[model samples]
Target: MKVLMVEDDLALGDALGRVLQGRGFEVTRCADGVEALAMFRRRRPDVVLLDLSLPGMDGMEVLRLMRDGGSQVPVLVVTARSAVQDRVLGLNEGADDYLTKPFDIEELAARLKALVRRSHGAPELRCALLRVDEPTGAVFRGATPLDVSTRELALLKALLARPGQAVGKEDLHHAVFGDEPVGADAIEVLVHRLRKRIQGSGAQLVTLRGVGYLLIDEAMTEGPVAV
Candidate 1:
């Protein structure tokens, strides 16, 4: 699993990252809120561990930004703010889970895994010949893995989130670009590129005009799936 740790303490971050790595997680550490937010958008980690007392931008503000921007990639607040109000605030602000500092590493790992599972509705997603390992960020076409970029990965993730049904372009836009400014037609471009890349994967990316896009496996494939 890809884990992003937004922590200011160098020693702690290093230790925790190593621990998570040992547990088979891909960890990326960031020291402050700005880096955390930027990395969250660009890297698209499966789960986030955020510290509330971050420099420049507080963790709460970062969480708010993520929510406002419509990124639902599971966030877990790990902070020294252990007060009841703090926990309440964090959950209210869209954190999937909360863990106080000085926590057990095992428990942290369990929480992260649980959050990821909940996000995907399971640990693995299978759509015909395409398979997505939610934790490892590995998308496979049968035994061969697909060469997908971060943006393309984000798009595929969104599509897989709802198999066999059309997903609105606005929602996908939020997932890929967040608050980043770009042309309104950007989602269409992404769909076009992703469609080409996913060809012969026994999966289809379908465009529903006046609606959005839908992805389906061969088993569910029927009719002309696009506009």
Candidate 2:
């Protein structure tokens, strides 16, 4: 699952990101509310982990904007505000669940899973022989299980999420590296690895110059000669 974590605290965000990634999640984080909202629209994460005290815009306004924009994606408010009124306000403003800061990491993870499960059922995604077992975060080719790193799985999942549609390099970077400070060639290297793994799997990863990469079924694209 993809999670858009909107938190201004650097330490907490970094720690949570690492933990969540270990627990079968693709986490992209933004510190500012403005950037968070923009990422929300672009990334279309399965769920959002929102912090009320944010810069540029408060969490309440961000939630309001999301609802205003007709987004029904689940939002979980994670903040230090533990007052009953605060929780009520958050829910009233469109938050699906609330989590007070300093909470247990396991609980947070469970809540995230619950929200995503309720909002979007865990459905397996596929493109030809490349299949993503959403529940276990496993990638399979036909009856064989293919070994893929977390980053590779993230990239493949992102492409498979939208079959036959080209995904931009920037978006792929966000999905794979999140906010990590990697080199410009990081994505290229990752793509090269995945392109090799999916070879002869009936799925082709085609690169569109100046656009990005897309996954398509090779069998579906083949046609008879036009005489």
Candidate 3:
């Protein structure tokens, strides 16, 4: 799992980073709120560990920006502020969990895992015969893993995250291409590629014309199953 750790304390961040790495999590460290928010927007992480006090921008403002931008990635606030009002404010800003500073490392790991599991809902996401193993981020058809590129997998995960909804082209672009500069029809091209890749899985990549794209079970769109 990937974790974006936003902490300004050099020693603390290093120690926590090592611990998280030992627990098999890929951690990206950022010292300030600006850099953290930039990284968050460029690519989605499994979870975010945010500190309330940050330079460049405040952690609360970062939380607001994340929520306002419609990113549903779970965030856990870790700070020295243990007051009830502070906790309440963090939750109101869309943090899924909160842990004060000087917390147990083991408990922190447990909370992070729980947040990821809850955000993913089930271990597997399904549509027709296609599935994604949330724990592994692997796309599968029946018992076989589908051969797909990293970008393809990212796009698939994004669509599956909001199944049946027309995800805007802009959002898909950010999810797949990130900060890379691409042409106007870049998302369309990627969608076309993904559509062909999942063709055997009985899932359809549907375009919403002026809207964007969505995924659906082809079987569901077929009428009456021939009765």
In candidate 1, what are the lDDT values of residues 1-227, reduced to their tens digit? 89899999999888788777866789999998998899999999999989999998999999999999999999989899879999999999998888888886655765676577778777356677887765445679899998887778778877887776789998898767655699978999988898888788878887888899888876664565553
C-alpha root-mean-square deviation, each candidate: 14.3, 10.9, 13.5
Instruction: Point out the worst 10-residue segment of candidate 3 by lDDT.
Output: 218-227
- Cα deviation of 106, candidate 3, in Å: 1.0
Off by over 4 Å in 3: 123-227
Q: Candidate 1: minimum summed lDDT over ten consecutive residues — where? A: 218-227
- lDDT scores in order: 0.82, 0.85, 0.83
- Tens-place lDDT digits, model 2, residues 1-227: 99999999999999999879976899999999899999999999999999999999999999999999999999989999989999999999999988887886755775687679768665457888888765356779998999998789888878877777999999899767766799999988998999898876888888888898988888887653111
lDDT, candidate 2, residue 151?
82
Clashing pairs in 1: none
- Clashing pairs for model 3 are none
Model 2: weakest 10-residue lDDT segment is 218-227
Off by over 4 Å in 2: 121-227
Error of 2 at 109 (Å): 0.5
